[model samples]
Target: MRENEPHRTGPVLIVIGGLPATGKSTVGRAVARRLGGSCLGIGTTRQSLYAFAEHGGDTDTLRHAVTHGLGYSVAYALVEDLLSQGQCVFAECVNSRKATRDAWAALARRTEARFHEVELLCPDPTEHDYWRTAGRALAEP
Candidate 1:
């Protein structure tokens, strides 16, 4: 994100997405590191929402229903700001739906930043299940 680098003028948004426990976060972090940029993860954003008490409540289920939308809103705003400053960004999300994927691409188009889509897949059911269950438990308190 240095000012003197030529790539600064050409902002890029690399989106890493896939099914649960497919290594999307790992790949997104690696891609962001390689590009010398920052990473925005939806899971982390959602967790933050939970921590901040912005998630589901008895009064209204609308916020709960739009949890993903809330994450995307924050992510898109961050992307717009970062791209406007000519900086690269990496976004990590499950992105299980075509609409979600297309929305990200549209965000890139609007920001005038180069869009790179990376989808990770794990063919081995055992490994995928391990990460889906045990891996998460080990990583969390």
Candidate 2:
């Protein structure tokens, strides 16, 4: 912070979530780009975590952690730090459960950051399935 800069209240944390083929990643990245902030994606983070574990971390345990709540826990800590520095953040996740969604909201409140929730939905099953299959085609490998 500059010596003469105005005091910041809090940064913004935009939560983008939805089903598997709801375009969470696409929308999260675009919004983060447009807003000039950072994006923390669960899928991306999961891959990174698993790759990091390449040193000695067990694949099964890592997978379980990522699937359960480890990803969100890590994101929460990261967002807390970023928000403390007045950096806006965009978090994209499947967020298939109420508990996950509430955790994001709670993080915003705890950090005193503005909470913006954007839930993407593909109402058309055909389009949704197409995206899902197309996404699978572009595997992480």
Candidate 3:
């Protein structure tokens, strides 16, 4: 088996962070698949939160904060669960803030698991803008 194979033993938290349309989700999923673990996306968590809140009754700011808070909690819980099961986990999020990145590092320390931070970026501004616009258009209702 490969060095990063799930059966190799030891828990790992693979954190994938990037801007919109930077392919964090795709890379995270690919990494998780290669490692035989699971992938979690903050966007998916946010969508679930919106569904749970019935898409109403809150200001956008409040909704965003709540969703982000819950998403972080859920990510921590997932990492803990996978660690307990001797499995690896891949998490994808924007994670633009230092505090957020530190929190993942702390989680790794608390869980005594290996942590890998992968930051995806698009070097070409024009191509990045094009991809971001296309992604936004595809994601819109």
Best by lDDT: 2
RMSD of 1: 3.4
Expressed as tens digits, the lDDT of each residue in 1-141 for candidate 2 is 666444435699998888887888888888677666889888877777777767685878887887778878888899889988888899998877889888988988988899988889999999999989889888746
Query: Which one wins by TM-score: 1 or 3?
Result: 3
TM-scores, one per candidate: 0.83, 0.85, 0.84
- Which digits, one per residue and each the tens of the lDDT, describe model 3 over residues 1-141? 666445656778888999988999888898788868889998887777766666567657657765658777776787778776767888899999998899889888888888889899999999999999998899889
Write down the lDDT of every candidate, Cα atoms only. Answer: 0.79, 0.83, 0.82
Native-referenced Cα lDDT, model 1 = 0.79
What's the TM for model 3? 0.84
Clashing pairs in 1: none
The number of the candidate with the highest TM-score is: 2
lDDT of 2: 0.83
Q: Name the lDDT value of residue 23 in candidate 3.
A: 96
Order by TM-score, highest first:
2, 3, 1
lDDT of 1 by residue, 12-106 (tens): 98888888789888887876776678888888876776565654465245457447487677778887798878788888888888888898889
Candidate RMSDs in Å, in order, are 3.4, 4.2, 2.7
